[model samples]
Target: MEFLQQNWHWATLAAVTGGWLLIDTVRAKADKTLLSAVEATMLINREDAVVIDVREQAEFAQGHIPNARHIPFSELESRKNELEKLRGLPLILCCASGARSGNAIATLKKAGFEKLFNLRGGIFEWEKAGQPLSRGSKNKDKEKGKKK
Candidate 1:
C-alpha cells in the first residue's frame, strides 16, 4: 500500500494502458477482423474475398497472393477510389509479414469500408501453409535481362 501510494501515477498509467489493450483485443475478436492463412483462404473461396497486396512494387513483383490487387500501403489513401467497387466485398489486406496490412485496416475503415480483414502472419504464413503464390512480372523481366 505504501509503495503504491508513492507510485500511484505509474499504477494509474499501467491500468489505463492495460484497459485500452484489453478493449482493443476484445473489439477485434468481436468483429472477427483478423484472419489466419487458412481462414483467409476460406474467406476467399466461400465469400469471394478480394486480397489486396500492400507491399511496394518490387516486393509484390517477387510474388503475391494469386489475383490480389496490388496497392502499396503508402498509396492506399490516394488509390482508395479504385477499391470503391470492391467495397461491398470482403477485402483482405496483406504484406510480407502482415504488419503493414494490419496497420492499413484503419485506413480502409476511415474510408467507410466495413468488411476489412488483415492477413494473420501475412504472406509468410500463407507460404508456410503451402498456399501457392502467382509469381509476378519481375522474375520474367529479370530472366529476360540475362542473356546466355
Candidate 2:
C-alpha cells in the first residue's frame, strides 16, 4: 500500500498492461484459427475443401475461385439450406479481402455450420500467392449461369 501510493502511476501502468495481456491471450485462441494462403491451398488440395465466396454477385462475377459457390452475405441466412450438401466438407469462406468472410464464418457458425474457414486476406492474397484463376472460357460460363 505504501509503495503503491508513492508510485501510483506505475501501479496503474502495470494494471493496464496486465489487463491487455489477458485479453490478448484470449484473442490469440480465436485468431489462431486463421489460415495462411499456403495452408488454405493445402487443405483444399488434400481435403477436397469447398470454397464459398461471400462477395456480392457482381463482385463474384468479376472473378472468383473455380467451383466456389456464390452466396452473398445478405443471402447466406436464407440460403443456409443450399449449403447442406457441403456440410461435412471444409468450407473456405472468402471475400475481396477477409473482413466479409470473417463475418460470414460467424454467421454460418450461428446457423450451425461446423466446418468453415475465412480465407486469410481472401482472393487478394490468393492472387498474391501466385495461385491460378479461370481463363476467359470458364469465366464466361459462370457469368452466363448467373444471368439465369
Candidate 3:
C-alpha cells in the first residue's frame, strides 16, 4: 500500500490503459472493415479490380482513377447495365470522402455484385498517399462545357 501510494500516478495510468484495452476489445467486433490505400492497391493488382467513382458527374470529371468507370450515384440505378461487363470482378468504390462510395457498395451488393470494396477514406486518402491521379484535359473540357 505504501509503494502504491507513492506511485499513485503510475497506478492511475495503468488502470486507464487497462480500461482502454478492455473497451477496444469489446468494440473490435463492431468495427467497420476499412481498406487502406496499400491494401487497395494490392486488391486492384491481384484481383484485377474495377474501380468505380460514385461521385457526381462534375466531381468525377474533375478527377478519378485512370481506368475507373464513372457511375455517379444518382445515375447508378439507371446505368446498372453499363457495369454488366465488370460483374464477378472485384469492385472498389470511391467518392470525395467515403459516404457516397458506401452507398454505392450497398447498391452494387443489392444488384448482385459478389465482390465489393469501399475505399477507406476515398480519393482524399488516395491523394494524400501520393497515388497517381489520371491525366487528360478531355474530361475537364467536358466539365467546362457543362458549366457554360
The numbered model that scores best in lDDT is 1
Global Cα lDDT for candidate 3:
0.82
lDDT of each structure?
0.90, 0.84, 0.82
Off by over 4 Å in 2: 1-30, 135-139, 142-148
Ranking by TM-score: 1, 2, 3
- As a whole number from 0 to 100, the lDDT of residue 6 in candidate 1 is 100
- Lowest-sum lDDT 10-residue window in model 2: 131-140
Report how far off residue 93 is in candidate 3 (Å): 0.5
**lDDT per residue, candidate 1, 25-137, as tens digits?**
88867767789889999999999999999999988988889888889999999999999999899999999998999878999998899999999888999999999987866
Summarize candidate 2's per-residue lDDT along 1-148 as a digit string, tens digits: 9999999999999999999999977774577546667878888999999888898877887778777888898898999899988899999999989999999999889988887888888888887988765433445786888999
Which candidate, 2 or 3, would have the higher lDDT against the true structure? 2
Task: Write the residue-wise lDDT of candidate 3 on 1-148 in tens digits.
Answer: 9999999999999999999999976764454445667878888899999888888877776677768888889999999889888898888889989888888888888989877888878988988988877744446657877999
